[model samples]
Target: MFYNREIYKILPEKAEEFCDFFEQYIMPVQIKNGSKLVGKWLTESRDEVMVIWEYPSIEEYRKIIERVSNDQIGRKHQEQLKKNQPYLIKTEQFLTKRDKPERSNQNITVSGYIVNDVGEMLLVRTYWRSDTWELPGGGVEDGETLDHALCREIFEETGIIVKLFGITGVYSNGETIAIIFRGKRTGGELRTSEETKEVGFFPVDPVNLSTYVKRGKFIPRVLDAMNGQYIPYEAFQVRPYKLVKRYDGEI
Candidate 1:
């Protein structure tokens, strides 16, 4: 997607008049000329307004500009804008190219740590990997939120309904990004799904964990949850074939 961001700085007293002009005349004309209005926002101080217009691509944006230039309705709107020039102070615009949608090579997983009243943690042993026990979770489906995916996966694997508390930890191993959440059992009986060979809550201790959990990181994660230690969310920016930047949120 391509975006044209227009920033209008106006006199504080004329803010309402400018917004009225935009809604009554400018917006309709722009929409009719193939411009998609993404949104319009007012800054906290109310002295500035920002309008985001979207187009499929730079080519489409150029076409819209050309069409609007010759459009009769657009010309009329421009004339009206001149008549209300006192309400407008200054305007600035810039074009931005949005990242294209593409198939991702990275894998995202959402897992839950559901502790019962007795402090036992939920564990699952999959039929395909019966030698190692792990948290009841799975890959996130397309268009599914992290919380929804965690709830669905936990219920599917262990037949337990849980209320998520918050994020416990986020771990990335180059290719896979795993988001672990803390939760408590709300209701439901312990029943194994077709993919799971066993589902039950076990004592939340490192000794008991080492005997059942296969992943080495699971022990420390469990200990962290017991100690109430949490890592904040982190966002990353990646180029098509390269890593670009990573931003970590305050804990």
Candidate 2:
């Protein structure tokens, strides 16, 4: 979850008019895309307007923003901005992550960190998460080992069979826990799956990662996997009391 706040400083006695203009042009499109308005407030002097919005996740927020800024909707928003110039004095905004609560019944997910022979990293864009490109992987199925899950997901999403080396990082929000694995592409051709709209390798530029992965919570995971230390991972069967395999990891 995430929050977005907009602060608008308007000319004296213009708060109501500004709010009305915003409600007509911007709020509807945002709501249609699953953004919720937390509340709207005015200063004691009634010269400033402040509104807070909530979104289910950063990726959803990104998709909503893109929807609101493109085609006819974007033109409408721009027109409103021009009209508000008479009353608008200044504007400010910031985005923040929601506080995570204690976990219960969290869903486990897996993602793969794969690089190609020429140093391009694999990424995929899905129809649902269309606004940004993300690492190729998905939810772990029951009865599947972590390594097997990562390999299968990578193949299913990007048509690339991978040789996973080690665990890159373990991350959790209140609702979901995600484990990332580091590996290199071993075989198969690049192609998109039904779940993926676009799939390919892209250059990993520190200055440009945000262009592809706009979600705040996701960028760090990619960076940590790309530059951080790798940890050993193993699969074993408790009933048989036997170790199936182990990954020594690469630096």
Steric clash pairs (candidate 2): none
Which ranges of candidate 2 are over 4 A from the true structure? 1-104
Positional deviation of residue 87's Cα in model 2 after best superposition, in angstroms: 56
Model 1: how far residue 246 lies from native, Å: 22
Model 2 over residues 1-251: C-alpha lDDT tens digits?
46788888887677677778777876766664446788988898888888888765566577778766763755787887887777676564656643555323466789987998997889989755678888888756546899998899899888899988888899998667889988899999999865677999999877899999977887888998888568888899898699998987853
For 1-251, candidate 1 gives per-residue lDDT tens digits of 56788887778888888889888777876775556788999887888999999765566577678767676767887888787677675565766643556544466888888889998989888654567888888767656667778889899778899987667778887656888877789999999865576899988586567788877866666665566555544333346554332212212
Please give each candidate's TM-score: 0.51, 0.59
User: Model-by-model lDDT, in order?
Assistant: 0.74, 0.78
- List residue ranges in candidate 1 displaced over 4 A: 1-100, 231-251
Error of 2 at 121 (Å): 0.3
How displaced is residue 192 in candidate 2, in Å?
A: 1.0
State candidate 1's TM-score: 0.51
lDDT of 1: 0.74
